[model samples]
Target: MKFSTNELLPLVSRLDQLLRTAEIGDYPGAFNGLQIENQGVVSRIVAAVDACEAVILQAAREPGTLLLVHHGLFWSGAQPIKGILYRKLKAALDGDLALYSSHLPLDLHPSLGNNVLLAKSLGLTGLKPSLELKGQSVGVMGKIKPMKREKFEALLCKSVGGRVHLAPGGPETIASVLVVTGGAGGEVARAADLKVDAFVTGEGPHWSFTAAEELGLNLFYGGHYATEVFGVKALARWLSEGTGLPWSFLDHPSGL
Candidate 1:
């Protein structure tokens, strides 16, 4: 089923308001909302984590498709639109592929956001927002049955469907699990204040390891790309349900 971009615009706009993308702070490259305009007709919607060269080129192959992604192109600010970047743009435009990106907004969404989805996936109930970033609560804090750290780590691995890296930095009996999917290891200390026993996120830098230990927070480094898949899939499902357009996920994990 084909759907017009105009029909999807209101939904997208409502999502912007719901996510407070404009009110919230994000990278300039985030450029939330519609980054690429197509021929007003979108037949199939493809959801992915990033719009890298490979994903863009793949989208170009399927002309007239809308590529909904979490991290859109242009993270590095403006360039002359030449070389590989130019080819990316040309491929997208020439293929009539439209791109829409959501960064912090997607991460912080209450219902369909990545944090909430990740938390729910872990069977976490009674969730509360935590770890505010850029004036938004992109991280989630929740309770469990107070299992051992090892068991909790195993459950978390099951939740994200990826191997989890544990620092074993905090207490053995973990009562709470805080999740901020995607490269949030830098904020390990932030979890300390939330009173959670463990912190779950995508990948983080090396310093975060010692920091997690010093901060006495259990750190679980789930793959960044793996943890971030929730939001795009949720948004795409919502869009497909609302618009009657078929959708599929282009899951190309970076495995970071």
Candidate 2:
């Protein structure tokens, strides 16, 4: 049975509720819902890690696809609709496409979030929250037994499937490491607070390198796009299984 946009709204909201209960994002953060809607009839769906121009173009070509993304437009909250942004929105409006996004909530979800899922995929145990963001933990810290730094790096490289930059902090044998997916390397100091041996994340700032050096915590950069793709794909799988909408991933390669 086909589900109209209005019919699917509650289902989407239910899915969002699940994600929110799991602590997907800051929760209080803005732009967590349906950002744009069309004529209220959605036939096909496109799920991507980021809602970029390319993904929007793909959605446009799909005619009635509802674009579900991890990162939505208007991150800065408000911006003049002109240039590229204007073009993207025009494309969606002209094609009658709808847009929905989930950010930090999708990152920390235990079953389908980027950090926890990556921890599970790597067979990490004793997963706990990071110490950085008080009142809430946005990343997962865990134990990895004792392994050589090179071997651990090899594992991460294989898991992420790209060039990984490793900054070994302390001993060659690592007992515990922290995992935070996508642009979270800046929180490596949180690993120091927990006394973790290594930290794995998508990308980090220049200060992250210096901080890891001083803290004696190994740092690994797994390429933000590569690390973040899994969670949305997992979400798409859940949507297919739960709502029987038959979802497919719109793989838009992001080189960042």
Q: What lDDT score belongs to each candidate, Candidate 1 first?
A: 0.83, 0.77
> What would the per-residue lDDT of candidate 1 be over residues 172-222, giving only the tens digit for each residue?
998888999999888887777887899999988999999888888899998
Alpha-carbon runs more than 4 Å astray in model 1: 1-11
Model 2 TM-score (2 dp): 0.90
Clashing pairs in 2: 24-104, 24-105, 25-104, 25-105
Per-residue lDDT of 21 in model 1: 74
C-alpha TM-score for every candidate: 0.93, 0.90
> So what's the TM-score on candidate 1?
0.93
Candidate 2 lDDT over residue span 119-233, tens digit each: 8777799988675463668788888869999988888888877678987776788878788888888777766777878888888888988788888888988888888888888
